[model samples]
Target: MVSNMAGGQPPWHGTEPDAPLGALEVYAEQAHGYLGASGDQLGKLAGLLRPPVLESWLRSLRGRVDPMDALDDRGLRGADLRRYLQAHPIAALMPLIDKLLVEDTAATGLMVVVADQFGRVLSVQGNDERVAAAAEVGLRAGDDLSERRIGTNAIGLVVRTGRAAWIHGPEHFLYRMRQITGAAAPVHDPDGRLVGVLMIAGGVRVARPEILALVKATATAAEMDLLLTAMRPGQRDAARRDAGRPQPAARLGLDVLGLGQPQLSIADRRIPLSQRQAEILLLLAEHPEGLGADHLALLLDDSDLDNGTIRAAMSRLRAVVGPAVFGSRPYRLHVPVATDVEALRAALDSGDVDSALRLHAGPVLPRSTAPGIIDIRDELRVRLRIAVLKSGDPGVLRRWTSGAEGRDDAAAWTAYRATADPETALYAQIEAKIRVLDRRMGADATRMQRFGA
Candidate 1:
């Protein structure tokens, strides 16, 4: 999309992954530098970021968010969210949202998220798995995507400038959130009052120049729907109506295994979580039956912690996670919590070792020492090792043996040897490593026997 070029704040357009549309490489590189730059260096390279993104970046910087801070972005939820939704004009537009954006895009694998003028997400509707993926990254209903909260996102940009906009991957302010790309448009009520922002989040497939147009079109449709729905009989005027829309909301991913750093991805942001938080969350996820506060406390720690302490901890966690996720009768998850662990388990159970290997990023929460976490960790590790050994595929075995967890695994190395032709150098190397391990094991056994004496 060419620069329309008019006012100080120009009417914005869309984004493409690469040129003949725009200089994505140049802008992305400059964004990286701009985000890293110190005070004076920041102004020096101002022109490169494209005025819209730079302005939003400035607003984001002025706001509470730090580009480098771990994103803990949240929106509204529970009773408070229900009240807000009921009162907001966007509430009437949900049917249109469900029909035009959510249902139409279901098979296309895109996601639709609606946010108020403040950029706090109102509703997220789409394919079930896609919605779950979005939730993992803090992009669910009641989560804020405002420039002040998450920084330089498509939704927040539209709110900042009151125009249609698209933000590409690296254009995002938060560092870890650079994996996402999205396009958004502002929805105006029939009276032209700013209703909210509609965003479509997805992968690079959404980076095409037409994405903003699609967003704009859907946003316009939402606006028109508000108009028609608001009109009583034959009311025909711009003043009679009310609305908001998205990026694909589609490509959501939760990574608990990558480098053992657990993060949630929705749209273009990856909200980071603490290890303890991740442990409690994943444990809750494991037990669909829901653990009681006492049992939950025991699972979280070996010590006999009181329910009050657990409740306090749960309260703090609930603030970060929002209220709709957990139920009180028994501490249970109200939604499907997908993780690399579950994905890997599914893959392994289906006898798909290749998929399991791809999903296994070392052991789950490698540093976690909680008994429940340790239990899951050990169980998953053993299961993965068994699957890897059973595969007999040299490439799969090589991948397993290459990891730190499996580097000294004698069985895996032996399996690799069995799969390889004896003449191959790889086979010889496996043999050599196994011999070293055997010698080490024998020496350790001898030392143990002497100690027993």
Candidate 2:
């Protein structure tokens, strides 16, 4: 590995040809200049880079004269580079790329070029014969071969379309392109920005569908690495968006357990949910407490039924909700999946606030209007409303509790009326509220920072 440890090196300075061009690209050429070669080493480096006609040809291409015209210009400036290096550390991806090339020597026979989000070459890897051949046509590591320069190649087309693309055989726009087939796929950051492009090039004989699949796979692998490295747990999904895959909808605990009725959205999609199942889900979601059979039966207006009948309802409810909620416990439903209450409890118990915050997506149950579940729902409303007061910041809480003001106030007053001793359960409620408010405030700050507000 070339050592560009000093401050003035190019981004690719100390990196091996297979390594990514991360922060090192921003420094002046002198930084990387040292690693480029001196005396006999210069000849060896030149042989690998394949200078002369190749460099001259690249210099003539359109969009070939800017700072990014050369691969060395892809590194960000001081602050931007710091931000980038913090997340997109070259250390993680470079080793993997090197291993891929070394292990897949036969596959590496094809010209492989890696570029920054802006289409500037970051690195290139190829076997000797292919390197020489590509050099003849002005394609080498760190060269500006964007579509704007060479016109309609895989790299350029993928960049333009933000999708995987192939420019095979005669599809090349340039007159000198008859020698190869290339496939390029977009690589994205957690934000779905075009962070990089990965391309594979080979002669027509190797232009099979599998070859394109390999290229796309490489791009996807690269993106997953970037996302895992950069994102805090929640932001990882945003990175996957570049694949154009819809996220599986957020699984409310009941849905995960198949205990709720499915309602059709505006798309007229039917979601199947039984009335009893829906009632139970809404009730649990409304009241964090496990509802006793007697309580449930009363609220359900099924007083005429015997205890055995109520027990049957409770048994059915338990089966539908899945065993994960609570293990043979009576009357208390505890969805195994973390809710705000559980997350706060975890944070309090374990002192891992990030873990707690990550687990809590919203209030335990969100936005249901089941009339039969109203009594339990009111309890949940009061608990959460008190939680808001204690926490002091309602950030996303307001969104969660939106339009439930009447119910929430009613619940608060009802709770006050039920317990004559004002001090009862007061500490627990205060603690929950304090934690919730703090969380909301932090979330708000995060949203503001993301939007530059």
Over 260-315, each residue of candidate 2 has an lDDT whose tens digit, in order, gives: 33331211123444565555555554455566665656656634446687677666
lDDT of 1 by residue, 1-453 (tens): 333223122223323333332445345555566666668867744555656777788777765356776535333457556645554667767887777777777777777878887676888776788778767655678766767557888888888789988777777887666766778899998778888998888666667767667778888998888777657353323212310001111222356675657875532356677887788888887786899988888788899989898888788767655565678769887644556676576556445576678878787888877899889898988888887877777778999889988887777777788988899887788888878877977756534422431
Q: How close to the true structure is residue 73 of candidate 2, measured as C-alpha lDDT?
A: 32
Per-model CA lDDT versus the true structure: 0.70, 0.46
Best by lDDT: 1
Window of ten residues with lowest summed lDDT in model 2: 261-270
| lDDT, model 1 | 0.70
Those runs of model 1 whose alpha carbons end farther than 4 Å from true positions after fitting are 1-26, 234-453
TM values, all candidates: 0.46, 0.33
Q: Can you give the lDDT of residue 271 in candidate 1?
A: 63
